[model samples]
Target: MRDYFIRRLLLIIPTLLGATIAVFFITRIVPGGPLEARMRQAMAMASERSMKDAGGSLSEEQKEQLAAYYGFDKPFFPAYLIWLGAAPQEVEKQFIKFEEGQNEAKVTLKTLLPRAQWTATNAFKVSEATVDRKGALTGPDVVGWKTKAEPEKQRVTVFRTKFNGLLQGNLGVSTRYNDRVWAMIKERMPVSIFYGLITFILTYAVCIPLGVIKAIKHRTVLDNATSVVIFIGYAVPGFVLGSLLVVYLAARMGWFPTGGFVSDNFSQLSVSGKVWDLTHHAILPLICYMVGGFAFMTMLVKNNLMDNLAADYVRTAIAKGATFRGAVLGHALRNSLIPLATTLGQIVTVFVGGSILIERIFDIDGFGMLSFQAVTDRDYPLVMGVLVVSAFLTLLGNILSDFFVALADPRIRFR
Candidate 1:
């Protein structure tokens, strides 16, 4: 079992690589990218200028600057490698001038706060130039010589590269929001986690017991009534249910808050007040989030338990002077839970976020909403950043499910 898990863990690297490579390449090929959007904006501005005087298009230098700014200047593979932190990311070019009178020349170079070497080329001779966090130049004295004898103002461009990507814990910056991608993801993660955790706990907590009761009381009025309700919930989507709840419960009856994860002054509340505030805000959304899963999980538990109860071992246990509760709880219930245990790991992925439409309907700022906005705005960095976290979690969840299955069923063993 240990060796099997080790192999699964190692396989995640290549699996994730293959998945991300497809998505990374697709982002590059897609239209309406950052560069195109910038160009459209520039053209719109130029059109406005045309009304005032004459139309002006972006120059080649301006286009190249835009391309470089969005990291679109590199080829597909190099850009992907840089994003994975396997290749160095190019920083903005800095220039230094060697004047005739100045004895010592100092130039401030922009860096990602890491120690890096800046090489000067074209009409300048620089040896081993390095910059610290404070942007101070170090190393041997910088010397410059021109082709002409007379000393002249010689401008030399410095090239610098930094390894900033997934390996470096940098997800790049969002082209749309102009913010760090990981920062945005971190900011919205909590809201989704709160909803997801609550939904998971409540779904299992309520569904499992209810399923047991239904299975035991099969063909009774209690079972028939609950089945109708469960099917209704299964048929209705979470977002649609959320809308109905908001309208009827919030808009008409004024029972619950309309939408949002919390109140405006949530931070200012006392401890118990904060708890009440969260509960108050959570009621409607939580109901919507749990409804769909509640139905399916309940039915799954009921059917599995029923099947196990009818098995030969359960009948034998009951015939051997064991109580009905013992036969159900000790023997049948354990076997019935194998399917649920196998799927338990998959539920972990929801810690990142909930349904996008449900989030939009509730006006909650969560990871799901961030992902939707990133894709809609064509924010490549943010999209890829979200994908990286999500894909990793999903893959890990699958392995976890397998481990859980092994634990639930003693007969199962990994080779």
Candidate 2:
């Protein structure tokens, strides 16, 4: 069992590496470079105030600087090499001579930062040189200006912020937000994590029992009535459902908050007040999101249970001496899990990224909301990060599904 678990866990590294590579390539090559994201976001905020407002418009020169900082100025292979934790970056710069009296003074520095070597955020190496004010250059690639300042006087220190560490790994900073990529991940992920947990529990709680009972009492009036409800849930699109709920329930009953995270100043509220407000806001989105997964799970579990009813072991167990309850719960249900296992496998992929439409309609502040913003904002890093996370979850879901199936079925063994 330990060996099996270890092998399964080890598989994740290569899987994630492949996903990372694919994400890196897809994000870079896709139309509308990094600046497009920033531009779009700025426009979104400003456009609220104007008929149409362009925010933080970038010049061609500024665009070049942004690209250089991200090492997008480098060849694609070099960019990939840096991302993959390989290759020494070749640097660039020039030399300038200042005629101070008869004795001439020369300094080696960046073309951009005249007094210093501009530390490119994700750069491999930046060659230092001298260029005149008009933009002409002279001399060696490495900084070796003759100076009188002592031991390291000859050495020019480029602005070297910590780039490689546990925190700052291969992936560069976000093109949209000014902060580090990892930092953004930490800040934004909690909302999604909370969202995932809450919705998942709600979905499963409503689905499994409903499915089991419907299966146990197949063809009854109760089953028929339940089926109609489930059908309606599955038939209606999440957005349409959310809007209807919002208009009828929220607008009419005045029971739910329409938008944003928590109350405006939830911190100031009393403990119960905070809880009440939080639950009030969350209920509508939760109910609407649950409809899709819950209804589907009900149908899936019912179908699987029906199939398991005919499994050889189930009938054989009953014939031997087992009661209906024992035969169904102890034997058939165990086999039934194999089908539910597939549904569970799909959960991570489907649920994690699934509620986008619902969240947007309900105005829920979660990853789904961020995704909606990313599309409109055209924010590639946020979009790619969210997508890569989704892909990772999907792969994880498949792996877990296989492991669960093997664990549930003792006859199956990995040699």
Q: How many residue pairs clash in each candidate?
A: 0, 8
On TM-score, the leading prediction is: 1
RMSD to truth, every model: 6.9, 8.2
Query: lDDT of candidate 2 vs native?
Result: 0.63
Clashing residue pairs found in predicted model 2: 91-126, 91-127, 92-127, 93-129, 94-129, 94-130, 95-129, 95-130
Candidate 2 lDDT by residue in tens digits, 157-227: 12222223212353344555655645655555666666667777777777777877888899999899999
Candidate 1, residue 211: lDDT: 97
In model 2, the Cα lDDT at residue 399 comes to 74
Residue-by-residue lDDT tens digits, candidate 1, 255-320:
988888889999999999999999998888888888888888999999999999999999899999
The candidate scoring highest on lDDT is: 1
| TM-score, cand. 2 vs. native | 0.72
Task: Give the TM-score comparing model 1 with the true structure, all chains together.
Answer: 0.85
Estimated TM-score for each candidate: 0.85, 0.72
Candidate 2 wrongly placed segments (more than 4 Å): 1-23, 36-63, 88-170, 311-321, 343-354
